[model samples]
Target: MTRFAPYLFSLMLLFVAACGGGSDQQAEEQTADTQAQATEQADDVRTIEMVGIDRMKFVVEGEEEGIKTGEKMGDYVLLESITAEPGEELRIRLTTESTLPASAMAHNFVLLTMNADATAFANAASKARDNEYIPADMEDQIIAHTDLASGGETVEVTFTAPEETGEYEYICSFPGHYSGGMKGILNVEG
Candidate 1:
């Protein structure tokens, strides 16, 4: 009976070890699956790029700006509009080309909520120099925004399109830029 007892103790140890090891294996598999899913989702993001010229215009690649055909792109106007399906992932790139310094002439992209007051927000942002021309009080109204990009520099931001289907306003809250016509409409489809 003593010899059998020793054998039984060894069997118990082996069983305990096996069960503990299975939990670790399952945890590792779950971690790997989560990483793979994140990678796949990142790969599905869509990218859009635009150039912010010295005239305070957003020059969309492969698109014409201004009120007339082949007119030189200028500020105080919407360069182009964006359309997307509800809840889509987007990456917006803003590249600035200006001879002036950052404080003098920098650009950014600010997407606002459906209910946000574009004029009021921009007015508030003008005084928010410390916050990159984005009013802190209106953070909840912002969907996404890129950092200020100076001349010869580029910046980008990634965000999910709003689940609600409607038109949203996007602008550059750089001082009087919004009033100068540096705003556009984002069309989110139902």
Candidate 2:
């Protein structure tokens, strides 16, 4: 009976060890899955890449660069309209593809909120040369913007879409670029 007792204790220990090891492995797997999900969510932000061409046009990457406007608003041309879900994350990357010098030709992305006067904002921005053509006083009207991108340079900005569904205007704030037709619309849908 004593010998049988030792064998029974040994079997109990092995069972406990096996069960404990399995729980630890399960915990590690769960942690790995959580980290993978976090990484995937971070990568989910949509990226929209466009180029500022010589004709004052913002052409979506891989799209035709010719000056084609879907609609014209005063001096600004609606080159494109991109859609997004409300509160979705967005990353806008703007690159300058031109042969002209920076002083002669540069570009910037200025996204204005709905209800904001885009024409007035652009006019104010045009005079803000000391501040990279971004009007400091009217910054409240802007939802997002990027730094000036000169020829052969690139600039990027990331912002979350507004919760309210509406059309937001975006334009190049370079002195005469907006008037030359460098603008688009960001439509946020419910």
Candidate 3:
């Protein structure tokens, strides 16, 4: 119980942060902050849409998954390779198209910051099922992300693109997805 204190506390903070306080003054302040933040994040946003398949793959527009390349899964083509300008806003819309039930197959987008360890983060996230597959301690490592999308459901996340020019990786933090090659890159430039 004691060990769970920090994790629980963090979760509480995240919940409070996500939901505005239950007071007139706090509600008004929260609304103002949210609107301003939304304006900044939605301004000139670049939208990217994708679909999550049960095979742990992201299929882009008009594309189907599991086309045999006769190559290994590592050689499997990238799910999404994006390009964007530094400091710009990017909105990722994810729709899950799995035939499997939601409890068996759901997907979420997790974009890691430059210094975060992808494998380590994914490993931790797999244990955080109750938290939408997001690890509690990894809040600082994530630049932006969307909630888990159950089958046939859609989720979206908007964020300011990193101000640094480089490649950043994004992945599905579902238990086995990232290890199964459900990942991609975001290339940012000034």
Candidate rank order under TM-score: 1, 2, 3
Q: Report the C-alpha displacement of residue 70, candidate 2, in angstroms.
A: 5.7
lDDT values, one for every candidate: 0.82, 0.82, 0.81
Question: What's model 2's lDDT at 43?
Answer: 89
Error of 2 at 125 (Å): 0.9
For model 2, how does the per-residue alpha-carbon lDDT over 117-164 read when each residue is reduced to its tens digit? 888888998899999999999999999999998899989888999999
Instruction: Give each model a TM-score.
Output: 0.71, 0.70, 0.69
Q: Residue-wise lDDT of candidate 3 within 1-190, one digit each (tens)?
A: 9999999999999998878747788889899989956865767566676777777887665423322122223323335677788887777889988688887899999899987889999999999988989999898999999999999899999898899999888999999999987888878867
Q: Which ten residues in a row have the lowest lDDT in candidate 3?
A: 66-75
Error of 1 at 79 (Å): 2.8
Off by over 4 Å in 2: 1-42, 63-79
> Which is superior by lDDT, 2 or 3?
2
Index of the highest-TM-score prediction:
1
Q: Which residue runs of candidate 1 sit more than 4 Å off their true CA positions?
A: 1-42, 64-78
- What is the lDDT, from 0 to 100, of the residue 72 in candidate 2? 42
Query: For model 1, where is the 10-residue window of minimal lDDT?
Result: 63-72
Name every residue pair that clashes in candidate 2. none
